[model samples]
Target: MGSAMNPPSMSEAKPALSRRRGRIQLLLIVLGVVGPMLLATGMYKLQFWVPEGRSYHGELIGNGQTRADLGVQADEQRWQILVTAPKDCAVDCQQLVYLARQIQISLGREAGRASHALAAAQPLSADYAARLDREYPQLQRYPLDAGVFARTTGDKAVPQLWIVDPHGNLVLRYEPNVKGKDLLNDLRHLLKLSNIG
Candidate 1:
């Protein structure tokens, strides 16, 4: 009778202890998954579509003063396409010039909605310059300012195109190797629905 009233031995307690430990282990596994997922959601919300850190690259030109010299006139609405090329263009360099022209033509009837610029690259052949002027006179030519050019060009390569909308916002950057029709499609989308200043 005394032995019967005594507490159970360690061996007898093992199953209950194991069950309790398993419940705690399961709870920890759940928390490990849930804790990191909640953190990731919060971080994504803060990164994009918010104006937290929108400092621009390159010298932000024509921010205050309106310029007619670049044909980016205050009154005329156009998308300014700027390209960075070396002082003397190699084979890859000529393709970029051709690329800019094709992008404009690819705009088709909406071609007037955009313009191009060669930043820092040297002058072209008389025929080439004349042809560009004839075909897309809105395209401006500027010697690339070394300082601004460096800022926009990153580790891999220089950004091929930086487009400023009519209201003068740097909104789009297309990679250097982009095809003309693809960029034109993007431009068409921009031009269609937008009537805002």
Candidate 2:
């Protein structure tokens, strides 16, 4: 009866303390592994802590669409500034094409990692074709399928420029009136952040 009433011996208490310590260590390990995943899931689902301002000037293509969705057959392995002309390459389209070329050239040392391209729904006029040939020898060209382009873009008729990744994923898109300086800044930021082309 006295033995039962007395405090637990040190030898007996050690195992109990060790078991408690082991349980705490195990709990910590579990939390360390699971905590981040839970937090990330919560943040994503709840859309909390997201900033309102965007670092990029162009509209982001978050739908995971690729250049193929635009109906242009391009196999470029580097980053591309693709100007899409769903109609004839009119003045606005021509300006965007010129801007695309200038943007690539302005990239300076990083220019080799990127290329400029034009995809037109209709063939350029003979005079404009000759001019592009003479003036923009490095310009890559593709034929834009009007039907496919129409399906993809709905009724939007305005020509636009796209920043495509090395893997052909569409990134940012700019309207016809986008400034060259703003586009240049966006490309520089993308190049700085990207490891791939």
Model number with the top lDDT: 2
Screening candidate 2 with a backbone cut-off below 3 angstroms (N, C-alpha, C), the clashing residue pairs are none
Q: What C-alpha lDDT, on a 0 to 100 scale, does residue 93 get in candidate 1?
A: 55
Model 2 clash count equals 0
lDDT value for model 2: 0.93
All-Cα superposition RMSD per candidate: 10.2, 3.9
lDDT of 2 by residue, 114-154 (tens): 99999999989999999999999999999998888888888
Each prediction's TM-score against the native? 0.52, 0.78
| Model 2 segments more than 4 A misplaced | 1-43
Per-model CA lDDT versus the true structure: 0.61, 0.93
